[model samples]
Target: MSLRISDAVVWQETGEGISLYHTETGDFRTLNETGSKIWLAVAGGGGAQPVASALSREFAGTDPALIKRIVADVHAFIGTMVDQGLFEESPA
Candidate 1:
């Protein structure tokens, strides 16, 4: 599946991190540096696997187990964002 930011949400990049506002629900979220990177990847139309791969390359030389953990975390993060209505998922 591919992921995209929800139409009801708007975001801005700040000095410290990224800020997201859900226009429909008035919900607000702040993402740290790593989260912002993942958010940007998804916003650019990346699916979970591509995002995980990109992150793995960026952190190349890390332990294999840690890489697996990172991949799982990326998937979890995207899932949570979808559950919170901050992102929409569709068939790739």
Candidate 2:
């Protein structure tokens, strides 16, 4: 599944990171580089596989063994966001 931004949610890029605001619920979230990349990847319709691929490429040779854990962590993190009402699953 991909992800859809909540209704009326606004996002902005700042030097520090990415900022998100949901006007209807008054919920806001701030994300660092990795988070921003994940958010953008999802917003662009990249599903879990593509998301994982991006993460893989990001840290390709740095720590080959850590890639799996990193990808899994991102998936889990995104899943939690869905539960938190920050995002919704979308059709592929």
Q: What is the lDDT of residue 63 in candidate 2?
A: 79
TM-score of 1: 0.93
- How does each model score on TM-score? 0.93, 0.82
Give the best candidate by TM-score.
Answer: 1
Compose the digit string of candidate 2's lDDT tens values, residues 1-92.
77776667788888878899978778887998988888888787777778877887787656777887887888887887687777788777
Q: Ten residues in a row with the worst lDDT in model 2?
A: 56-65
**Alpha-carbon runs more than 4 Å astray in model 2:** 62-64
> Candidate 1 residues 1-92, lDDT tens each?
99999999999999978999999999998999999999999989899899998897687557898788888888998899999999899998
Any idea what lDDT model 1 has?
A: 0.90
